[model samples]
Target: MNKMVKGRIYTLIGAIGWGLSGACGQYLMNDSAVSPIYLTALRMIIAGVFLTILAFFKQPEQFKTLISTPKEMFQILYFGIFGLMLCQLTYLIAIHDSNAGTATVLQYTCPILIVIYVSLKEKTAPTVMEFAAIFFALVGTFVIATHGNPFNLSLTPAGLFWGIISAFTYALYTLLPGKLIYRWGSLIVTGLGLLSGGILFYIGSASWQYTIQWKPYTFIAFIGIIGIGTIFAYTLYLEGVSLIGPVQGSLLASAEPISSVFFSIILLGEVFQGIDIVGIVLILIAVYLITMKEQLQEKHMRIKH
Candidate 1:
Protein backbone atom coordinates (compact mmCIF):
# COMPACT_ATOMS: atom_id res chain seq x y z
CA MET A 1 0.00 0.00 0.00
CA ASN A 2 1.04 3.56 -0.55
CA LYS A 3 2.39 5.41 2.46
CA MET A 4 -0.21 8.16 2.22
CA VAL A 5 -3.01 5.62 2.04
CA LYS A 6 -1.62 3.81 5.05
CA GLY A 7 -1.41 7.10 6.87
CA ARG A 8 -5.02 7.83 6.06
CA ILE A 9 -6.02 4.42 7.32
CA TYR A 10 -4.11 4.96 10.56
CA THR A 11 -5.70 8.37 11.06
CA LEU A 12 -9.20 7.00 10.39
CA ILE A 13 -8.79 4.13 12.82
CA GLY A 14 -7.29 6.44 15.42
CA ALA A 15 -10.26 8.77 15.09
CA ILE A 16 -12.61 5.82 15.45
CA GLY A 17 -10.77 4.87 18.60
CA TRP A 18 -11.48 8.31 20.06
CA GLY A 19 -15.16 7.84 19.28
CA LEU A 20 -15.08 4.54 21.15
CA SER A 21 -13.44 6.35 24.07
CA GLY A 22 -16.35 8.75 24.39
CA ALA A 23 -18.82 5.86 24.24
CA CYS A 24 -16.85 3.95 26.83
CA GLY A 25 -16.71 7.03 29.06
CA GLN A 26 -20.48 7.41 28.77
CA TYR A 27 -20.95 3.73 29.54
CA LEU A 28 -18.80 3.99 32.63
CA MET A 29 -20.50 7.13 33.83
CA ASN A 30 -23.92 5.49 33.46
CA ASP A 31 -23.14 1.92 34.49
CA SER A 32 -20.12 2.10 36.80
CA ALA A 33 -20.97 5.39 38.52
CA VAL A 34 -17.60 6.96 37.83
CA SER A 35 -17.12 10.64 38.60
CA PRO A 36 -16.34 12.69 35.54
CA ILE A 37 -13.58 14.67 37.25
CA TYR A 38 -11.92 11.59 38.66
CA LEU A 39 -12.16 9.79 35.36
CA THR A 40 -10.57 12.75 33.63
CA ALA A 41 -7.73 12.76 36.10
CA LEU A 42 -7.11 9.05 35.75
CA ARG A 43 -7.26 9.30 31.99
CA MET A 44 -4.75 12.13 31.88
CA ILE A 45 -2.30 10.35 34.18
CA ILE A 46 -2.42 6.95 32.56
CA ALA A 47 -2.54 8.23 28.99
CA GLY A 48 0.20 10.68 29.79
CA VAL A 49 2.47 7.87 31.01
CA PHE A 50 1.73 5.76 27.98
CA LEU A 51 2.33 8.55 25.50
CA THR A 52 5.51 9.55 27.27
CA ILE A 53 6.79 6.00 27.01
CA LEU A 54 6.00 5.96 23.32
CA ALA A 55 7.74 9.28 22.89
CA PHE A 56 10.81 8.08 24.73
CA PHE A 57 11.17 5.16 22.37
CA LYS A 58 10.02 6.85 19.18
CA GLN A 59 11.70 10.22 19.67
CA PRO A 60 14.27 9.99 22.41
CA GLU A 61 16.02 13.19 21.42
CA GLN A 62 12.80 15.19 21.51
CA PHE A 63 11.85 13.81 24.91
CA LYS A 64 15.27 14.66 26.28
CA THR A 65 15.13 18.15 24.86
CA LEU A 66 11.71 18.78 26.38
CA ILE A 67 12.76 17.79 29.90
CA SER A 68 15.97 19.77 29.69
CA THR A 69 14.29 22.99 28.67
CA PRO A 70 13.52 24.94 31.85
CA LYS A 71 12.48 28.21 30.19
CA GLU A 72 9.39 26.79 28.49
CA MET A 73 8.13 25.16 31.66
CA PHE A 74 5.54 27.83 32.24
CA GLN A 75 4.07 27.44 28.77
CA ILE A 76 3.88 23.66 29.08
CA LEU A 77 2.34 23.96 32.51
CA TYR A 78 -0.30 26.34 31.23
CA PHE A 79 -1.04 24.06 28.30
CA GLY A 80 -1.60 21.17 30.66
CA ILE A 81 -3.93 22.80 33.17
CA PHE A 82 -5.88 25.27 31.10
CA GLY A 83 -5.67 23.59 27.72
CA LEU A 84 -5.74 19.79 28.10
CA MET A 85 -7.09 19.33 31.62
CA LEU A 86 -9.95 21.79 31.44
CA CYS A 87 -10.77 20.70 27.92
CA GLN A 88 -10.98 17.07 28.96
CA LEU A 89 -12.94 17.80 32.11
CA THR A 90 -15.51 19.95 30.37
CA TYR A 91 -15.89 17.45 27.53
CA LEU A 92 -16.60 14.61 29.92
CA ILE A 93 -18.93 16.81 31.90
CA ALA A 94 -20.75 17.66 28.70
CA ILE A 95 -21.03 14.00 27.83
CA HIS A 96 -22.31 13.17 31.28
CA ASP A 97 -24.78 16.02 31.22
CA SER A 98 -25.99 15.36 27.71
CA ASN A 99 -24.65 12.48 25.56
CA ALA A 100 -21.57 11.53 23.61
CA GLY A 101 -23.07 12.55 20.28
CA THR A 102 -24.06 16.04 21.36
CA ALA A 103 -20.87 16.65 23.31
CA THR A 104 -18.64 15.61 20.42
CA VAL A 105 -20.48 17.73 17.84
CA LEU A 106 -20.48 20.75 20.07
CA GLN A 107 -16.78 20.35 20.77
CA TYR A 108 -16.20 20.36 17.02
CA THR A 109 -16.99 24.06 17.04
CA CYS A 110 -13.44 24.78 18.23
CA PRO A 111 -12.31 25.68 14.72
CA ILE A 112 -14.70 28.59 14.61
CA LEU A 113 -13.49 29.73 17.99
CA ILE A 114 -9.93 29.57 16.69
CA VAL A 115 -10.85 31.64 13.67
CA ILE A 116 -12.50 34.25 15.81
CA TYR A 117 -9.53 34.30 18.14
CA VAL A 118 -7.08 34.82 15.28
CA SER A 119 -9.19 37.65 13.93
CA LEU A 120 -9.21 39.33 17.31
CA LYS A 121 -5.47 38.95 17.87
CA GLU A 122 -4.73 40.32 14.40
CA LYS A 123 -7.17 43.19 14.85
CA THR A 124 -8.96 42.28 11.65
CA ALA A 125 -12.41 41.15 10.66
CA PRO A 126 -13.21 37.62 9.59
CA THR A 127 -13.11 37.00 5.88
CA VAL A 128 -16.18 35.83 4.02
CA MET A 129 -15.42 32.15 4.58
CA GLU A 130 -14.58 32.73 8.20
CA PHE A 131 -17.84 34.62 8.67
CA ALA A 132 -19.70 31.73 7.08
CA ALA A 133 -18.05 29.31 9.46
CA ILE A 134 -19.07 31.46 12.40
CA PHE A 135 -22.64 31.61 11.15
CA PHE A 136 -22.85 27.87 10.67
CA ALA A 137 -21.37 27.18 14.10
CA LEU A 138 -23.73 29.63 15.77
CA VAL A 139 -26.81 28.35 13.98
CA GLY A 140 -25.80 24.77 14.60
CA THR A 141 -25.27 25.36 18.28
CA PHE A 142 -28.58 27.19 18.50
CA VAL A 143 -30.34 24.26 16.84
CA ILE A 144 -28.93 21.85 19.35
CA ALA A 145 -29.54 24.07 22.35
CA THR A 146 -33.08 25.11 21.40
CA HIS A 147 -34.20 22.51 18.86
CA GLY A 148 -34.52 25.31 16.32
CA ASN A 149 -36.97 27.25 18.52
CA PRO A 150 -35.87 30.29 20.48
CA PHE A 151 -38.12 29.53 23.46
CA ASN A 152 -37.83 25.73 23.45
CA LEU A 153 -34.89 24.44 25.45
CA SER A 154 -33.86 20.95 24.44
CA LEU A 155 -30.38 20.44 25.93
CA THR A 156 -29.71 20.91 29.59
CA PRO A 157 -28.10 24.14 30.73
CA ALA A 158 -25.09 22.33 32.14
CA GLY A 159 -24.64 20.33 28.98
CA LEU A 160 -24.70 23.37 26.73
CA PHE A 161 -22.50 25.32 29.09
CA TRP A 162 -19.83 22.65 29.43
CA GLY A 163 -19.97 21.86 25.73
CA ILE A 164 -19.33 25.49 24.87
CA ILE A 165 -16.53 25.67 27.41
CA SER A 166 -14.99 22.53 25.97
CA ALA A 167 -14.93 24.16 22.53
CA PHE A 168 -13.09 27.21 23.77
CA THR A 169 -10.64 25.21 25.80
CA TYR A 170 -10.04 22.81 22.97
CA ALA A 171 -9.23 25.77 20.78
CA LEU A 172 -6.84 26.88 23.46
CA TYR A 173 -5.42 23.38 23.46
CA THR A 174 -4.74 23.76 19.76
CA LEU A 175 -3.35 27.26 19.94
CA LEU A 176 -1.35 27.24 23.15
CA PRO A 177 1.34 24.76 22.23
CA GLY A 178 2.06 25.85 18.70
CA LYS A 179 5.64 26.89 19.46
CA LEU A 180 6.29 24.00 21.83
CA ILE A 181 5.04 21.41 19.37
CA TYR A 182 7.04 22.99 16.58
CA ARG A 183 10.23 23.04 18.61
CA TRP A 184 10.11 19.83 20.63
CA GLY A 185 7.69 17.87 18.48
CA SER A 186 4.09 17.03 19.35
CA LEU A 187 4.65 13.59 20.87
CA ILE A 188 7.04 14.72 23.57
CA VAL A 189 5.36 18.07 24.16
CA THR A 190 1.88 16.59 24.43
CA GLY A 191 3.14 13.71 26.53
CA LEU A 192 4.76 16.14 28.92
CA GLY A 193 1.73 18.41 28.80
CA LEU A 194 -0.54 15.52 29.75
CA LEU A 195 1.75 14.65 32.61
CA SER A 196 1.66 18.22 33.86
CA GLY A 197 -2.13 18.34 33.73
CA GLY A 198 -2.47 14.92 35.31
CA ILE A 199 -0.21 15.83 38.20
CA LEU A 200 -2.14 19.01 38.90
CA PHE A 201 -5.52 17.34 38.60
CA TYR A 202 -4.50 14.40 40.76
CA ILE A 203 -3.31 16.59 43.58
CA GLY A 204 -5.54 19.63 43.24
CA SER A 205 -8.72 17.73 42.51
CA ALA A 206 -7.97 14.99 45.03
CA SER A 207 -8.95 12.42 42.49
CA TRP A 208 -7.95 9.66 44.91
CA GLN A 209 -10.93 10.56 47.08
CA TYR A 210 -13.33 9.17 44.52
CA THR A 211 -14.08 5.44 44.43
CA ILE A 212 -15.06 3.23 41.52
CA GLN A 213 -15.81 -0.42 40.95
CA TRP A 214 -13.02 -2.44 39.36
CA LYS A 215 -14.98 -4.88 37.30
CA PRO A 216 -13.80 -6.47 34.08
CA TYR A 217 -15.84 -3.98 32.10
CA THR A 218 -14.26 -1.17 34.09
CA PHE A 219 -10.80 -2.23 33.01
CA ILE A 220 -12.06 -2.65 29.47
CA ALA A 221 -13.45 0.85 29.39
CA PHE A 222 -10.32 2.27 31.00
CA ILE A 223 -8.08 0.53 28.53
CA GLY A 224 -10.26 1.91 25.79
CA ILE A 225 -9.80 5.42 27.12
CA ILE A 226 -6.16 5.31 28.15
CA GLY A 227 -4.74 2.83 25.71
CA ILE A 228 -6.64 3.09 22.47
CA GLY A 229 -8.39 6.43 22.64
CA THR A 230 -5.55 8.60 23.84
CA ILE A 231 -2.10 7.03 23.41
CA PHE A 232 -2.67 5.15 20.19
CA ALA A 233 -4.93 7.81 18.77
CA TYR A 234 -2.38 10.53 19.38
CA THR A 235 0.51 8.47 18.06
CA LEU A 236 -1.19 7.33 14.88
CA TYR A 237 -2.82 10.65 14.16
CA LEU A 238 0.50 12.43 14.55
CA GLU A 239 2.25 9.97 12.27
CA GLY A 240 -0.51 10.26 9.69
CA VAL A 241 -0.52 14.01 9.86
CA SER A 242 3.24 14.09 9.43
CA LEU A 243 2.84 12.07 6.27
CA ILE A 244 -0.22 13.70 4.70
CA GLY A 245 0.35 17.21 6.11
CA PRO A 246 -2.02 19.38 8.17
CA VAL A 247 -4.48 20.31 5.46
CA GLN A 248 -5.56 16.74 4.73
CA GLY A 249 -5.05 15.77 8.35
CA SER A 250 -7.47 18.42 9.57
CA LEU A 251 -10.04 17.25 7.06
CA LEU A 252 -9.56 13.66 8.10
CA ALA A 253 -9.67 14.57 11.78
CA SER A 254 -13.35 15.42 11.32
CA ALA A 255 -13.86 11.67 11.52
CA GLU A 256 -13.56 11.86 15.29
CA PRO A 257 -17.01 13.44 15.77
CA ILE A 258 -18.63 11.29 13.09
CA SER A 259 -17.31 8.19 14.74
CA SER A 260 -18.47 9.48 18.09
CA VAL A 261 -22.01 9.91 16.79
CA PHE A 262 -21.91 6.48 15.22
CA PHE A 263 -20.72 4.71 18.36
CA SER A 264 -23.14 6.70 20.49
CA ILE A 265 -26.09 5.66 18.36
CA ILE A 266 -25.05 2.05 17.77
CA LEU A 267 -23.41 1.07 21.05
CA LEU A 268 -24.88 3.48 23.57
CA GLY A 269 -28.33 3.56 22.02
CA GLU A 270 -28.35 7.36 21.94
CA VAL A 271 -30.95 8.92 19.72
CA PHE A 272 -30.75 12.18 17.84
CA GLN A 273 -33.65 14.16 16.49
CA GLY A 274 -33.70 15.24 12.85
CA ILE A 275 -32.86 18.72 13.99
CA ASP A 276 -29.89 17.41 15.90
CA ILE A 277 -28.61 15.75 12.76
CA VAL A 278 -29.09 19.02 10.92
CA GLY A 279 -27.05 20.77 13.57
CA ILE A 280 -24.28 18.21 13.29
CA VAL A 281 -24.15 18.57 9.51
CA LEU A 282 -24.01 22.32 9.77
CA ILE A 283 -21.12 22.18 12.22
CA LEU A 284 -19.30 19.82 9.89
CA ILE A 285 -19.90 22.23 7.05
CA ALA A 286 -18.27 24.93 9.15
CA VAL A 287 -15.30 22.67 9.73
CA TYR A 288 -14.82 22.09 6.02
CA LEU A 289 -15.21 25.75 5.24
CA ILE A 290 -12.59 26.71 7.79
CA THR A 291 -10.24 24.04 6.52
CA MET A 292 -10.56 25.27 2.95
CA LYS A 293 -10.03 28.84 4.05
CA GLU A 294 -6.87 27.87 5.90
CA GLN A 295 -5.58 26.07 2.86
CA LEU A 296 -6.33 29.06 0.68
CA GLN A 297 -4.60 31.43 3.08
CA GLU A 298 -1.52 29.27 3.22
CA LYS A 299 -1.44 29.04 -0.57
CA HIS A 300 -1.74 32.77 -0.94
CA MET A 301 1.09 33.35 1.53
CA ARG A 302 3.31 30.92 -0.36
CA ILE A 303 2.61 32.65 -3.67
CA LYS A 304 3.18 36.09 -2.21
CA HIS A 305 6.48 35.13 -0.67
Candidate 2:
Protein backbone atom coordinates (compact mmCIF):
# COMPACT_ATOMS: atom_id res chain seq x y z
CA MET A 1 0.00 0.00 0.00
CA ASN A 2 1.01 3.59 -0.57
CA LYS A 3 1.96 5.86 2.29
CA MET A 4 -1.32 7.74 1.99
CA VAL A 5 -3.34 4.56 2.13
CA LYS A 6 -1.32 3.25 5.09
CA GLY A 7 -1.68 6.55 6.88
CA ARG A 8 -5.44 6.49 6.38
CA ILE A 9 -5.76 2.90 7.53
CA TYR A 10 -3.64 3.48 10.59
CA THR A 11 -5.48 6.71 11.34
CA LEU A 12 -8.88 5.07 10.91
CA ILE A 13 -7.98 2.17 13.18
CA GLY A 14 -6.63 4.54 15.80
CA ALA A 15 -9.66 6.82 15.58
CA ILE A 16 -12.11 3.89 15.88
CA GLY A 17 -10.33 2.51 18.92
CA TRP A 18 -10.14 5.90 20.55
CA GLY A 19 -13.67 6.90 19.61
CA LEU A 20 -15.13 3.65 20.92
CA SER A 21 -13.09 3.87 24.10
CA GLY A 22 -14.73 7.18 24.95
CA ALA A 23 -18.12 5.55 24.55
CA CYS A 24 -16.97 2.68 26.72
CA GLY A 25 -15.89 5.11 29.41
CA GLN A 26 -19.20 6.92 29.31
CA TYR A 27 -20.96 3.57 29.63
CA LEU A 28 -19.00 2.65 32.74
CA MET A 29 -19.76 6.03 34.22
CA ASN A 30 -23.46 5.48 33.67
CA ASP A 31 -23.84 1.74 34.37
CA SER A 32 -21.31 1.04 37.08
CA ALA A 33 -21.11 2.45 40.58
CA VAL A 34 -17.62 3.69 39.83
CA SER A 35 -16.92 7.38 40.25
CA PRO A 36 -15.51 9.07 37.16
CA ILE A 37 -12.33 9.88 39.02
CA TYR A 38 -12.01 6.31 40.24
CA LEU A 39 -12.79 4.88 36.83
CA THR A 40 -10.19 7.10 35.12
CA ALA A 41 -7.62 6.13 37.73
CA LEU A 42 -8.32 2.41 37.47
CA ARG A 43 -8.31 2.52 33.69
CA MET A 44 -4.93 4.21 33.60
CA ILE A 45 -3.45 1.88 36.21
CA ILE A 46 -4.58 -1.26 34.41
CA ALA A 47 -3.44 -0.01 31.03
CA GLY A 48 -0.16 1.23 32.47
CA VAL A 49 0.53 -2.13 34.07
CA PHE A 50 -0.01 -3.91 30.78
CA LEU A 51 2.24 -1.44 28.96
CA THR A 52 4.98 -1.70 31.58
CA ILE A 53 4.89 -5.49 31.42
CA LEU A 54 5.02 -5.42 27.67
CA ALA A 55 8.07 -3.18 27.69
CA PHE A 56 9.86 -5.20 30.36
CA PHE A 57 9.40 -8.51 28.57
CA LYS A 58 9.74 -7.36 24.99
CA GLN A 59 12.42 -4.67 25.16
CA PRO A 60 14.17 -4.74 28.48
CA GLU A 61 17.31 -3.04 27.19
CA GLN A 62 15.47 -0.03 25.79
CA PHE A 63 13.29 0.17 28.85
CA LYS A 64 16.34 0.17 31.07
CA THR A 65 17.99 2.87 29.01
CA LEU A 66 14.87 4.99 29.16
CA ILE A 67 14.80 4.83 32.95
CA SER A 68 18.51 5.48 33.35
CA THR A 69 18.39 9.07 32.16
CA PRO A 70 17.25 11.82 34.56
CA LYS A 71 15.79 13.78 31.67
CA GLU A 72 13.83 10.74 30.56
CA MET A 73 12.57 10.24 34.11
CA PHE A 74 11.30 13.81 34.17
CA GLN A 75 9.59 13.29 30.86
CA ILE A 76 7.88 10.22 32.15
CA LEU A 77 6.75 12.04 35.27
CA TYR A 78 5.57 15.01 33.27
CA PHE A 79 3.50 12.92 30.96
CA GLY A 80 2.17 10.57 33.62
CA ILE A 81 1.21 13.25 36.10
CA PHE A 82 0.56 16.40 34.13
CA GLY A 83 -0.40 15.00 30.75
CA LEU A 84 -2.21 11.77 31.46
CA MET A 85 -3.60 12.27 34.93
CA LEU A 86 -4.56 15.90 34.53
CA CYS A 87 -6.12 15.50 31.10
CA GLN A 88 -8.19 12.47 32.01
CA LEU A 89 -9.26 13.76 35.39
CA THR A 90 -10.13 17.21 34.15
CA TYR A 91 -11.93 15.86 31.08
CA LEU A 92 -14.09 13.50 33.10
CA ILE A 93 -14.91 16.25 35.54
CA ALA A 94 -15.77 18.52 32.65
CA ILE A 95 -18.10 15.93 31.23
CA HIS A 96 -19.85 15.66 34.58
CA ASP A 97 -20.29 19.41 34.61
CA SER A 98 -21.52 19.46 31.02
CA ASN A 99 -22.41 17.07 28.20
CA ALA A 100 -19.99 14.45 26.90
CA GLY A 101 -20.13 15.81 23.37
CA THR A 102 -19.36 19.29 24.58
CA ALA A 103 -16.48 18.03 26.69
CA THR A 104 -15.05 16.05 23.81
CA VAL A 105 -15.17 19.06 21.50
CA LEU A 106 -13.56 21.24 24.11
CA GLN A 107 -10.73 18.80 24.64
CA TYR A 108 -10.17 18.66 20.90
CA THR A 109 -9.31 22.34 20.93
CA CYS A 110 -5.83 21.02 21.69
CA PRO A 111 -4.98 20.61 18.03
CA ILE A 112 -5.62 24.25 17.31
CA LEU A 113 -3.66 25.17 20.40
CA ILE A 114 -0.86 22.92 19.17
CA VAL A 115 -0.68 24.75 15.89
CA ILE A 116 -0.21 28.01 17.71
CA TYR A 117 2.27 26.46 20.11
CA VAL A 118 4.37 25.05 17.32
CA SER A 119 4.35 28.33 15.42
CA LEU A 120 5.31 30.32 18.48
CA LYS A 121 8.12 27.93 19.32
CA GLU A 122 9.43 28.43 15.79
CA LYS A 123 9.07 32.21 16.23
CA THR A 124 6.82 32.69 13.26
CA ALA A 125 3.32 34.01 12.86
CA PRO A 126 0.64 31.70 11.46
CA THR A 127 -0.46 32.20 7.89
CA VAL A 128 -3.85 33.51 6.75
CA MET A 129 -5.28 30.07 6.09
CA GLU A 130 -4.35 29.00 9.58
CA PHE A 131 -6.27 31.94 10.99
CA ALA A 132 -9.23 31.06 8.80
CA ALA A 133 -9.20 27.50 10.13
CA ILE A 134 -9.05 28.77 13.68
CA PHE A 135 -11.94 31.06 12.96
CA PHE A 136 -14.07 28.23 11.57
CA ALA A 137 -13.26 26.02 14.52
CA LEU A 138 -14.13 28.73 17.00
CA VAL A 139 -17.37 29.50 15.25
CA GLY A 140 -18.25 25.83 14.91
CA THR A 141 -17.47 25.23 18.56
CA PHE A 142 -19.64 28.17 19.55
CA VAL A 143 -22.51 26.81 17.49
CA ILE A 144 -22.22 23.37 18.99
CA ALA A 145 -21.74 24.52 22.55
CA THR A 146 -24.51 27.09 22.45
CA HIS A 147 -26.83 25.02 20.26
CA GLY A 148 -26.64 27.57 17.41
CA ASN A 149 -27.53 30.46 19.67
CA PRO A 150 -24.18 31.87 20.71
CA PHE A 151 -25.72 35.01 22.23
CA ASN A 152 -27.80 33.05 24.72
CA LEU A 153 -25.26 30.49 25.91
CA SER A 154 -26.33 28.03 28.59
CA LEU A 155 -23.03 26.47 29.69
CA THR A 156 -22.47 26.46 33.42
CA PRO A 157 -19.54 28.60 34.54
CA ALA A 158 -17.96 25.66 36.34
CA GLY A 159 -18.37 23.36 33.37
CA LEU A 160 -16.91 25.91 30.99
CA PHE A 161 -13.96 26.48 33.26
CA TRP A 162 -13.26 22.80 33.72
CA GLY A 163 -13.69 22.09 30.01
CA ILE A 164 -11.17 24.80 29.03
CA ILE A 165 -8.79 23.52 31.65
CA SER A 166 -9.08 20.06 30.10
CA ALA A 167 -8.34 21.59 26.71
CA PHE A 168 -5.23 23.45 27.90
CA THR A 169 -3.80 20.54 29.86
CA TYR A 170 -4.38 18.07 27.05
CA ALA A 171 -2.71 20.45 24.59
CA LEU A 172 0.29 20.53 26.86
CA TYR A 173 0.23 16.76 27.06
CA THR A 174 0.25 16.37 23.30
CA LEU A 175 3.16 18.78 22.94
CA LEU A 176 5.26 17.25 25.75
CA PRO A 177 5.24 13.73 24.28
CA GLY A 178 6.78 14.94 21.05
CA LYS A 179 9.79 16.31 22.89
CA LEU A 180 10.19 13.10 24.91
CA ILE A 181 9.73 10.90 21.87
CA TYR A 182 12.59 12.77 20.19
CA ARG A 183 14.97 11.84 23.02
CA TRP A 184 13.77 8.27 23.62
CA GLY A 185 12.03 5.96 21.24
CA SER A 186 8.24 6.27 20.98
CA LEU A 187 7.56 2.89 22.58
CA ILE A 188 9.83 3.51 25.55
CA VAL A 189 8.53 7.02 26.11
CA THR A 190 4.95 5.83 25.80
CA GLY A 191 5.49 2.89 28.14
CA LEU A 192 7.27 4.88 30.83
CA GLY A 193 4.93 7.84 30.62
CA LEU A 194 1.92 5.58 30.86
CA LEU A 195 3.41 3.75 33.85
CA SER A 196 4.01 7.02 35.61
CA GLY A 197 0.55 8.29 34.80
CA GLY A 198 -0.87 4.99 35.96
CA ILE A 199 0.77 5.43 39.37
CA LEU A 200 -0.86 8.83 39.73
CA PHE A 201 -4.12 7.37 38.57
CA TYR A 202 -3.94 4.63 41.21
CA ILE A 203 -3.46 7.20 43.93
CA GLY A 204 -6.41 9.17 42.64
CA SER A 205 -8.56 6.06 42.35
CA ALA A 206 -7.70 5.02 45.88
CA SER A 207 -9.16 8.22 47.25
CA TRP A 208 -12.48 7.77 45.49
CA GLN A 209 -15.43 5.54 46.32
CA TYR A 210 -14.39 2.24 44.84
CA THR A 211 -16.38 -0.96 44.24
CA ILE A 212 -15.44 -4.00 42.23
CA GLN A 213 -18.09 -6.22 40.67
CA TRP A 214 -16.84 -9.18 38.72
CA LYS A 215 -18.89 -8.88 35.58
CA PRO A 216 -17.16 -10.87 32.87
CA TYR A 217 -18.09 -8.57 30.01
CA THR A 218 -17.39 -5.42 31.95
CA PHE A 219 -13.97 -6.64 32.98
CA ILE A 220 -13.27 -7.88 29.48
CA ALA A 221 -14.41 -4.68 27.87
CA PHE A 222 -12.35 -2.66 30.31
CA ILE A 223 -9.27 -4.68 29.51
CA GLY A 224 -9.93 -4.90 25.82
CA ILE A 225 -10.80 -1.24 25.35
CA ILE A 226 -8.71 0.42 28.02
CA GLY A 227 -5.70 -1.84 27.59
CA ILE A 228 -5.59 -2.23 23.83
CA GLY A 229 -7.91 0.49 22.70
CA THR A 230 -6.45 3.37 24.65
CA ILE A 231 -2.83 2.26 24.56
CA PHE A 232 -2.57 1.30 20.93
CA ALA A 233 -4.76 4.17 19.86
CA TYR A 234 -2.36 6.71 21.38
CA THR A 235 0.78 4.85 20.35
CA LEU A 236 -0.32 4.62 16.76
CA TYR A 237 -1.54 8.18 16.66
CA LEU A 238 1.83 9.32 17.94
CA GLU A 239 3.52 7.10 15.42
CA GLY A 240 1.44 8.69 12.72
CA VAL A 241 2.60 12.07 13.97
CA SER A 242 6.17 10.82 13.69
CA LEU A 243 5.76 9.23 10.29
CA ILE A 244 3.51 11.65 8.48
CA GLY A 245 3.99 14.85 10.52
CA PRO A 246 1.95 16.44 13.31
CA VAL A 247 0.02 18.63 10.92
CA GLN A 248 -1.34 15.61 9.09
CA GLY A 249 -1.51 13.59 12.24
CA SER A 250 -3.50 16.28 14.01
CA LEU A 251 -5.85 16.38 11.06
CA LEU A 252 -6.27 12.64 11.34
CA ALA A 253 -6.70 12.87 15.08
CA SER A 254 -9.27 15.59 14.55
CA ALA A 255 -11.39 12.85 13.07
CA GLU A 256 -11.89 11.69 16.66
CA PRO A 257 -15.02 13.81 16.99
CA ILE A 258 -16.46 12.29 13.84
CA SER A 259 -15.87 8.83 15.16
CA SER A 260 -17.22 9.89 18.53
CA VAL A 261 -20.38 11.17 16.89
CA PHE A 262 -20.67 7.93 15.01
CA PHE A 263 -20.34 5.75 18.10
CA SER A 264 -22.57 8.08 20.06
CA ILE A 265 -25.23 7.46 17.48
CA ILE A 266 -24.75 3.71 17.21
CA LEU A 267 -23.77 2.84 20.76
CA LEU A 268 -25.51 5.52 22.76
CA GLY A 269 -28.47 5.99 20.42
CA GLU A 270 -28.05 9.75 20.58
CA VAL A 271 -30.20 11.62 18.17
CA PHE A 272 -28.47 13.93 15.70
CA GLN A 273 -30.11 17.03 14.39
CA GLY A 274 -29.35 18.99 11.20
CA ILE A 275 -27.46 21.59 13.19
CA ASP A 276 -25.22 18.91 14.67
CA ILE A 277 -24.46 17.57 11.22
CA VAL A 278 -23.52 21.01 9.99
CA GLY A 279 -21.37 21.59 13.04
CA ILE A 280 -19.51 18.37 12.36
CA VAL A 281 -18.74 19.38 8.79
CA LEU A 282 -17.56 22.82 9.79
CA ILE A 283 -15.30 21.39 12.45
CA LEU A 284 -13.75 18.96 10.00
CA ILE A 285 -13.06 21.67 7.48
CA ALA A 286 -11.60 23.91 10.15
CA VAL A 287 -9.32 21.20 11.43
CA TYR A 288 -8.12 20.37 7.96
CA LEU A 289 -7.29 23.96 7.16
CA ILE A 290 -5.52 24.56 10.46
CA THR A 291 -3.39 21.45 10.41
CA MET A 292 -2.48 21.85 6.75
CA LYS A 293 -1.12 25.29 7.51
CA GLU A 294 2.12 23.71 8.71
CA GLN A 295 2.54 21.95 5.42
CA LEU A 296 2.03 25.20 3.64
CA GLN A 297 4.73 26.85 5.71
CA GLU A 298 7.13 24.00 5.11
CA LYS A 299 6.54 24.18 1.41
CA HIS A 300 7.27 27.90 1.47
CA MET A 301 10.48 27.27 3.40
CA ARG A 302 11.53 24.70 0.87
CA ILE A 303 10.97 27.16 -1.96
CA LYS A 304 12.97 29.88 -0.18
CA HIS A 305 15.75 27.45 0.71
Which tens-of-lDDT digit does each residue in 1-305 have in candidate 2?
77766776677677767777766665566555446777677767766776677767777887788778887688688888888788887877776666556567667766678777878899998778878777777777676667688676656777778877898899877777877777666666666777788776677557455775545457755754586568778666655665676556667777677776677677767676777667667767877886676678778998999
Using lDDT as the measure, which candidate wins? 1
- Listed in order, each prediction's TM-score against the native is 0.96, 0.85
| Ten residues in sequence with the least summed lDDT for candidate 2 | 212-221
**lDDT of model number 1:** 0.88
Reference-based lDDT, each prediction = 0.88, 0.71
Which clashing pairs does model 1 show?
none
lDDT of 1 by residue, 50-91 (tens): 888888999887677767778787788889998899889999
Q: Candidate 2: deviation at residue 238, Å? A: 4.2
